[model samples]
Target: MLCALIGSACAGARDEGGTDEADGQGDEFGGSQECEPDPRGTEPEVALPSPHEQLYELELDTWGISNAGGDPVETRTRMNEALAWALDNGFEGVRIPAGTYRVGEKTSDIYTAGIELPGSMDLILDPGATLEMAPNDTWNYCVVAVRGLEDVRIAGGRIVGDRDEHSYGGADDEGHGVCVEGASKRVLIEDIELTKLTGDGVLIVGQSEAGSCEDITIRNSELHENRRQGVSIVGGIRVLIEGNEIHHIHGTAPQFGVDIESLSFTSKDIMIRDNSFHDNQAGDFVNTDGTNVWFQGNTLDQGDVTDQVDGPIVFWKRTDQTIRDNVVIMHSPTVNGLWGVIGYTNDDEPRANPVPNYIEDNVFEGGGIHLARNHGNAVIRANQIDGWMILGSRLSCLRLSDNAVNKAEGESYKFREVQGVASGNLLNGAPVALPMSDDAPFTNSPPHLW
Candidate 1:
């Protein structure tokens, strides 16, 4: 079996000699089972394996760190000391073997972090390696903190937070599982499970005035049952968040799966794709307030529960944004208010127009798209919506086309004082007329389909 797997992997590699044949075995009938050759007369480019894929055989026990599951004092002390020593000794990576390592104590201050990673290091955790945080009341710390670093990778472990023991007082009493701050760059956080945290599972922010967190990627992680967001990006550039499962986030006002917002700075070039967000209580499942953002191929669902979610995707004063090819399934019949797949502008803030945005080719199972306030040069096309497509007052230069809405309540297309062209749309199996200019007050109604 091992040989067959290796052979299969090697067969996928491109032939350097420009051969048009696959290097694989035969079928049960002794027929060729190789893949078809690429007809494009060009050698396929081979991707280099990631450095984090290298196995670390050295164990934490070698550095006098005990994994004895109780009283994390000694283990935490040794782990911190070992990290310092590894950085000073020029070690490329440190391995935490498969065991539960208790990190912080219940009585410790909220500002205490379990491990602080140095620059240019890989902290590899084995499959069963767990960092269990001691139950505490404070909310000002994190299990792992990476700051002012470059080329840092934290992969393959479980971070258990003390949510059951922690109490939420206010914004001051918030903790996190992992916090990446300062001028960190080229960071990769992958294949980790973060559960039951008092705050966000991962918080990536930029604190320095001269620099921003750059080129950060978080993928293939599971963040669930957290009190706050699954991942919160305060300020970062060129961030890619893909293939994560974030769910059941509650106990806060904005318990989003991913929250990308600007704090004292602006973030750019953010892409969130192929992630799963379900049962989060936030107004927006994946909220954004940044520039050049792309959210594609994600599944946002509100499970059959009593929680009220404002929307699946919310944008606030964003530019050059594209939300395409996403599926949003809303099953919460008792939700307070029904929201569309995409919501624009915030209630309290002054209405700012988002320009050059595209909402295309998305499937809204029980919702539609809401463009609130003024919007400019935006295109909403080819979407399958099961609810209302609402356009607020003063929207200009908008193009709505080829959208299909089924079982829509009230008006299939609700336009209030907007100048837009809506054409080629089918509503309740009939060609929709141009949206009527309604003077009804703007209100997010419940799903009438249910």
Candidate 2:
């Protein structure tokens, strides 16, 4: 169940769960690495242990926390004591049983396993429990973090933000729900609910280096009404984001519902499927930077969008991405901005490629599709676009074939069922890019959008 509103956006929002651009020291060798070596190839695989070994067997109550002995009151003492004890012991995880535990401030780095290196840890939540963090009047931070940790798994339960009177009501910004940073590989976050955050819902964002956030799996969770990006990721490789319910994405800042950027970050090999995105007022439900991504088997419903941000799903320049096998329904009534899939990219080659993208096997109930950028390929084929609208240039160079447009509002839909329009779109908008077309095609489509 959702908790009280705490306060509105005015309350100081929670901080970013992931680390900022420059927060940790250059090195933290003060701590030794404790995790075992991963055998699933050095490429960082997000693999969970066997069910029996997965259990940490360490309860928050057993740490001599304030409320651990009984149905004790929520306090800072319990949180500190519990977390400290977990760190001191050899336990790799700290479980929160069914209860409403509250902490007044930010604790030390408990999520990550290695400070300078990368390792994994687990934090499991019992059903129907809440972990509330007292709203900070100062800087915003995350309820929990997996920063600099590899093979990290945070699953189950609900993470709540307590922003009653002390909560800043929209005054504070940069707060986030949960953040998984760059260089953190094989991270899995599933079966949880994150609400009432003043910032983005969950951010698997990138940093300065070209490292990747690979093998990430987020399923069966709900993210609502975040102040910033709902699920923001940058500079990732081989990521899987599926089976989550994301809605009501309104914020005081100019926030996108979800964004995947690869600007000087090199975000690549992402699969986003089997999710439900609805009632968002900002930009697209899914947006990508200049990288390679695949968006399939999802449902998008536009509800109460009162802003000027573009797209139910928008991709920036030079991004070799795919949009297929999904259902997108919009009810904007009047033509608000350039309604539909829009692309925008100029300049060719070297740093940026203006190639067309490959689009196929999708069902567009309403709205339209636009090649927002001038570069890259737009391969629209074998799709069912009913009541579709187009908002881009002529596709004389595009590979348009084998598509079905029910009521095309513009001429771009003229090649739904045709061939050779655009296929294998790539970054820098190159015509022959083929960025996200993995060597081995995915055998199974992702689960449906929540």
Candidate 3:
């Protein structure tokens, strides 16, 4: 029980935060017994003693090595210094005792991290403590910046920014609560509240120097009231973004409650689930580039509007993905785009073709246009679609069959006499005549079925 050992010993700092590494036991994702070499043979050397073991050694040395007893604010400085000392002296685990710690210069009165932990370390924040950032220092934002490190975790605590200086990255300023560099991996950011970052809130960004960011998880958190996106995921592999409430993240820089975009390289195996996204203006809840992703069991609600953003979930240049069991509610397209899941071939030659994507068991209701425009091929089935049919008569060229189309707001079309079924549908206008309906499969008629 390495985590238990660290947890029990660091219990004294009820206010300050401490990192708990569960004793060499494996977690749901991967445990100690599952540690394996990279299939590519380029595995980064796995450190011995596990990070938890190293943390235990550091906690013992810190018992009376230093103290931040003068002012509660000094706790932040002490925490950073303690870890700095530990790292300098070859100690590994750094603990942060809790309490309200003020950041920035007292004369300036700007909120900031009382203690700053430099890049590269295993640091923990106690549940009761708070990390407040400076208001006037938008140029100097972000309470914690993890730059070029491996095996990092910031769990359980609150990181707040001054609402008055809410304009940190007002228009083009680049500020954040916590910005992780690309060279970092095995990162876990859990159970935290990040509020009012002028730029992007809790950004997991990749730098040019580092090829890509990988193996990240952001779970059980609340990201709200930021000038920009609540959470932005870029340039990563095997990313799990789940169980988060992202809302009221409005800003001038094309904001999205939760945006999954690619700046340079593509991200793979992205699983976004069990989350709630609502009230975002600039764009729909989820946006992304071509990648193997799974969007499941989530709720997306767009309030009253003329053009209620774009698609609740938009996929471009994507392939082999599954968009299932999602509840999309509001005033726009449940799905919009050539391919609900598009295939993109970048570069003149085009690398990967978009094909084999699944859009099933989704519910689209009220003022939403459910259409799939382009892509290689897609499967749209078992979806409860109701509202404006914005696409021209011809929505998709690849495939369409066994769908319950009812009370469509606009026109509908069939494959260019190419032969796809349109039988089991409740068409408000019966759609433009198709070349053939017998070639494809059609079942229960609209009113009777859906």
Displacement of the residue 263 alpha carbon in candidate 3, Å = 2.0
Best by lDDT: 1
RMSD of each: 17.2, 14.3, 15.6
lDDT of predicted model 1: 0.65
lDDT of 2 by residue, 198-245 (tens): 666676766566365666677788887676556767667677778888
The TM-score obtained by model 3 is 0.68
Candidate 3: lDDT over CA atoms?
Answer: 0.51
What would the per-residue lDDT of candidate 3 be over residues 121-230, giving only the tens digit for each residue?
66666777566665554344566777777777776677776655444332433457777666567777778887777656677777887766777778788887776677
For residues 126-224, could you state the per-residue lDDT of candidate 1 as single tens digits?
898998877655757778889887788888989988788765555532578888898688888889999888888998888856567888888899999
lDDT ranking from best to worst? 1, 2, 3
Candidate 2: worst-modelled 10 consecutive residues by lDDT: 1-10
Candidate with the larger TM-score of 1 and 3: 1
How many collisions per candidate?
1, 66, 27
Model 1 residue 140 lDDT?
72
Give me the runs in candidate 1 sitting further than 4 Å from their true place: 1-61, 105-110, 167-173, 283-288, 318-320, 333-336, 342-354, 435-450
Against the unseen true structure, what C-alpha lDDT does each candidate score?
0.65, 0.52, 0.51
Q: Which candidate is the best by TM-score?
A: 1
